[model samples]
Target: MRNLFPQRVLILFITVNTIFSLSGCVSHSKDNNDLLCVEKNVLNTANAEGSDALVLKNFEARPANGLLKEISVDLPAYESVVYFSTDHRDKILDAANRIFPWAAKDLQTIISKGFKPDPKAAEPSRNGLYVLFKLPNNEFLLLQGIASPDAMSHFTINDNGSLKIKLVTFGTETVSGDIPLVAYAKSDNLYDVFENAWKNAINTEALAGRTAMRHEKEYPEMFTYLGWCSWEQYRRKITSDLMVDAMQKIEESPLPVRWVLVDDGHQHQTGFKMGDSRMLSFDAHPETFPNGFKPLMDLRSEKIKWMGIWHAMNGQWQGLHPDHELRELDPHLIKIDKKFRGEPLPVMMPKGDSISSWMFYKGLIGSTKKHGFDFVKIDNQNRQMRFYKGKENPVKTVSQHAQSLERAAHELSGGLINCFCSDLLSLMNTKYSAVSRVSVDYLLNNMEKAKSHLFQSYQNTLWMGQAVWPDHDMFHSSDKFAGRMMAVSKAMSGAPIYLSDAPDHFLEELVTPLCYSDGKLLRPLAPAVPLPESAMISALTTPEAYRVVAPLPNGAAAFVAYNLAHPTPQQIVKTQISTQDYQHAGSFIQPAVPKWKVPEEGLVYYDWYDGKGGLLNDQYKIELDGFSDCFVQLSPVKKGWSVVGCIDKYLAAAAIDAIEYNQSELKLTMIEPGTLVVYNKKPVKCAMASKVEELGGGLWKIYFPKGKEKVDVTVTL
Candidate 1:
């Protein structure tokens, strides 16, 4: 075995003792002013490395805690941690995140300098569980737990300001063995350390691009889809008539909505209320949909193109009604719930016997398809990981069972499952789930809730977008107060823009941000995200930054900024436009709507709401009204051309849509009537356009009529 430090390292003092009778031995010592500890019998077997000085803490079990062992290590000043949890409740190796609160500068520096670990240096524990800490001094501290059949792990800070890693039992099992916990030190970065641990456990690199591509291949259609859901407006009171009315409204509107999702209220029973509560029969509620979900499904397919419905992952209230079709189809499908009192719980057995796992999922998903549903929103899935008990070998582990269930859902549903209210860890196993909710619900009642949605939308997209398309929930234009902010943020975030409003009250302004003039869905070039500072501050305190920006394929940058202070009565938020406001942008240009034109030297900024803008320098500032937000488009200015109107320079340069421009005569198309600005060095005569006026300073202003798809301007110099 390799010594953690060189033999020249001198030891100061050593203490050794045995705490638990069945557990292994524990020893602590000071060598070269470093704290060290050795734990024996962490696993069923002994450590191959007999002695290592750098091992900080090794524990079989703490007698004071009764089979629970804990260890704390100090973090270098200003250095944060990245904590990886095993599963939400029962899944394994599924979710990961950079933990603790991180400042903007720190996060930016670390994420920019990616780390690569040496594959051969990995040393994972038996169950392949380990924790890696990146220190400020450019070193890594690794904690490897004794491998067990299955375990759940997390980290917290102790009172003494030290990071602690804890492992506890989950699910219905309390089985325990030699609980081994070992620690190691390395002069490497956290990313490398994580890669080493992952290589040791699963023998693979945690390549971001590769993982993203895998999910993309698994869920092709969900990556970019336009849909409308019922939760934001109707909540749990959704009915067939409401759904049909919403579909009819969408069909009439210019919005390119494709999916009609039924959230929460369609089922016979949902939630945890038991006894008289109906079982999750996977059947529509008779009162709400007397004709069942088929009528709505048919209407959606004919009018909207696709259909989807929602259900709790554990069925109704973590138990199946004894009279449910699943139980009738297979006797062993639902195990009797002896874990509870009063009513005998009929727990869903998603894994185990062939009839319980395969046949149950097959019949359940097959019924939904036969009912005309094409997609499903699986919600409250974390409960499945926490409560499920397996009955067979090979699938004994929670991760195995979860994977099996997810696969069954994918295969039966034809790979169109949207996961909601699921823990981050279990989501990893849902390679088949097309869309995943990254944060909590998008509550639109107050400014605080609006801020939360904007904050989480950016943070979650940054951390989890690579794994799956982050679902930002639904937005509302008819909410009266928070509608504008909701519309702007959702449209810019590159997330699915689903609106839930009364059919007659649908606001056209809300749809402007989501679609182009021609009514095609406006897909963002990339997922919008906030800066590092925003994420760090949001974790500990109220996040002041509420912005999501993405680059367009037309070299224009689209951004949505929310003045969270807007909800306060009489509050005017003054925000400055700095160079950092759009570091990767060329010039701001609206992707969906035509806006103000920028001058030659300074850029022009246009607000989506009023289509207003003027020339501004780097230090310009703007004020916003209470509870309102703005969407802006930045288009890069070409070398020798100055634009005057709301013409899309990128589109004009590429002749996209109806925009076309050439050398002498600049020919363009306008979806909306707007003034155009043209800058030339010499005096030019303009003709053929609707109206032409000189704005002096070699800038010419031209006007085009609305609905004019073709316009020609002859320029003579």
Candidate 2:
């Protein structure tokens, strides 16, 4: 191994053997006269070249105390560590933010300088390592380990390279305050390293012209919605009544909703197999999709701008599956390695040449695309790396997983690609998919297990093989669903908003505006509630720096705010004017309403009370007592107003105002239990309205009377 330092470094294990509090002193030592702390809890040790000196520890116990997925390293800080857990990216790289400022600064400077272990100089470690620098201050930067996406703590560096993490309080609920803990030196360039690994996700050929639901400015930011729908879910929700109702709903979709992916249903269940696409059939389950894609498929695909399905490549199964029978013919691909609960972890090897891989994927793509899909979510390994032989060729590893999609995209000549449970862009280091899950899969429960979603969204993917997104998977509301949803997306900056809502049925009034797009996520003006709504919330990004804005209806003021490093839910909704943007956009007023306008403000809003199906007639007559906003897509409303709107509750509806609408842009406001309304600042005279269920569409004239007007409108349905 190459020695990266000039001399043998200090190798001390003084795990703060400081029994008694030391008398603060500034005495000179007969040795290296470096700055020294007077406390015995503080012991200085020189770093070395090859020792696993870096260790992860908690202030008190093992809460945020697991292995870290990634970390930075400092030469001579500690010998490289011995980590056996590669399947879960589970290792820690410690850093001395307080004591080793020089090292931190060095790591940043080196990485920023584009330093990396010369490929030729890379020494083989069962665990991959590089003299890599993803940021400036290289020579010793990022040295991350994997800790599965669902891990509780993805990263944790010591505050100082101290071996003891100091803690002043200890209790049952949580150990409060700082506790000195053992840590090794890491570089600040660490994050940029992984960021470079998966940045550039947006510029892919697949999601080129698409946009998130929030950025589509025709409606309220709250009307935006995104979800991950399995092909099975898609088949179930899309029906005749559902379709017609859906068309009406689409007209008032919250955000510009361009992408609605179909997860794990279009392809075969198990892989690591022979190369024919037989097992990986790209068609929907014939049982669920009886009529096939005839009218339902062709017509729906046209109305929605971006749509795709999923494929699981690195999955495992016993001989139970018919496909597993094929694997049984060659069970050698299946083996047990890593011990989980002392039980062997199952693994498998892919059996094929590049052509077979290509052909199989091509078939899958051809099949799915035939059903009217322009986007595809290619799933990855659901097991450990042991399944793929855990080799050093990450390029090969990523290729085995994403190659099919990339090749398929090439064949399709530019289509959206989505990846899950995979190192999506690490293979190409170029913009690949339209959206990608940066953290592990998001479980619906609110769990602050990971960091933050915004951190993952703004990752330095500019150069990494990604330009699409850091998808903060579908949002599930606890009591405060809409509020939490907005926070996560707003935090992601420009990452695409991916959701798992069952389409073809009820539409969700997601509460964040899709504001600006940078190929990643939509930028929002302000986000509302970001705290875990319930035990089911999982934060998957770093809580970086942010500015919070608690928005309320006109005149009614509010001041609820927070200071997270990164804002996730989203920011406040503001103007839609950009330096270079769509020409037809501006403060112009329209005289009439079309069949639909995604998230048209002041329009009628309608939905099943709890996102459930059935008539909402049970909620008692329109109790216009409290200002309530209704949610509906398309409906007739009074004209002659400037900005029209629809909301879920009147209280929410009362929150609407033309804070910044052009006076001549037209005004219309409709509120109460998801009702739609129309707006007209200028006179159009002509009006058209079609009624769908409780949702009524027809033109009525309402001259904006300097004050508010209350009227109970009738629904044709």
Candidate 3:
């Protein structure tokens, strides 16, 4: 592989998700011993760092403050001895690539290094490294990564202008759980933009990078501030009858129950239920489901779509249920690497127990068709990171996971698999469960908490075959507000949502959806239009409209005007009623009336709606004793998307229409500077709600209004 920048080594990565990258370096004036690594898409400076010797050193001090300090690499698989530094993160990477084009699968830099020229490129196999080749003329073409680590990195970027770079492996959690330090440029205002950059880095490093070797993953995005509960709570009360009952509920839940996570109870041999004694059976714990497995039967009838069995694959930490036949059966199965921290012990990838054991697990799958058991949840596990005994390839653990499911899939066409994890990353798609939890905990209130939970859920959902559906670990919110928040989450996301509450904590209304049904599910109307009115406006207006129309008090003006056309695109037209048309502004109504002067600046502080659930706000300066008729031109935010409603009978009836944008009258569209909404296009289909229902309690149900159907309403602008 030819060196694009022989002297440049340091590359930048977006974050924990994105992989480490390398790039050409730019020379900055060297100042003191304080050093920082910086590189970009283009090569601005050059140097000669001979590649004869290999340097390996780790920094004991924290990274330089206020400067870019990177510590990771982006290549999928390559030879490595880990060390991190601020000054050399960039230069060292460049030097390494020059000497080791075949070093990191050429992934550290999206350039195919060491490939044969011309006709040789046509050969079937590659080194399993991908690069986006943009020719000298700026022509772009997609190229895949090498197939294997042994393959040469042969690719090119002949373009002079098109910019490309690799990932950085900074800010990652080390095998020892230490967060490797990262330093950015002096102007590092690390927030959302910075966070996104890092996520992209590790993702490419781990996923796109070519290598069968797997690495542990991090999911700070989805799991931040999440709500989590210990399985012990349920274990405390597990009874054979209750276990059976819990399974039955699984049968009746809606939406496939995304994840019927089995918590800790099973391992304790904690047979609070009669099923306890049957632990040795390694078969269906029939006592747990006394009614002949009614729960599984119900799911088979379509209540729980995805079913699973939970296990503590690794944490054999507890000295309980010791089975002597374990090590004798398969030495590789029970023994763990000694290098692992703490008391050395084996960790289960697929499972450590007989129930989780390959043979036992395989048999259980076949026997449970009458009471669906399509998933498996293994908890208390981590990736193989430490130097340990009984060590195995990171791929092997995934291999076992795959073998576990592959055995099951042979019997069933498709299977639903998930696990209990705080970031179940590093597992291969084919080898790992279909879904896994990402957070160590879960919570509420902080808006980002809710939004990100869904975001994490969506990210995993988008995986083509659902390799990993993120688990926003479920919990029951005792508060109704929290419940509403959950509904909002369920409605506004793409993840397979689940909840874990003592069924009693859930309100009947909320649980109604998860209740047993005839398998026919009801889907709801989606893509709800955002209201045109501002939240501030919605708080001030009467029940006349979902939107609010208020006047900004301006002198000599009867009232200020406002329109709530925020959610969609529409041209709003209104027939105005003037002062001569209607007079006598309401005044002196209060027991203690206060005089409101015609202020030069039409802003008067009126205390209203305080007792009611509304915020009173309006600033207008005007004289109300006048007469005239006016109309508001309601239309889409875009000049091309707005239209005036056709005033069909002139003054007889009002109407709304989709054809609202006016091309020529862009000037009049904004009555004042900053008047036009710079945010969402305020389009709304306004008419009236014809029917409403009030339950015996305080709940009110409102339905959309239907105007003249099939008839077009021309909006008069």
Q: Relative to the true structure, how large is the alpha-carbon lDDT of every model?
A: 0.47, 0.30, 0.27
Clash totals for all models, in order? 20, 158, 105
Off by over 4 Å in 3: 1-233, 246-263, 267-281, 284-307, 314-332, 336-371, 383-420, 423-434, 442-469, 477-481, 490-493, 509-717
Mind giving the per-residue lDDT tens digits that candidate 2 earns over 416-437? 4344332322223223344444
Preferred candidate (lDDT higher): 1 or 3 = 1
Query: Which stretches of candidate 2 lie above 4 Å from their native place?
Result: 1-259, 265-280, 293-296, 314-352, 381-385, 390-401, 421-431, 443-468, 476-492, 501-512, 515-717
Q: Per-residue lDDT for 89 in model 3?
A: 18
For candidate 1, what is the lDDT? 0.47
RMSD of each: 11.0, 18.3, 20.7
- Candidate with the greatest lDDT versus the true structure: 1
- Residues 387-467, candidate 1: write the lDDT tens digits: 443322221244443455566667667444445433434444554554567655666565565654555556555434544
TM-score for each candidate, following the candidate numbering: 0.67, 0.42, 0.39
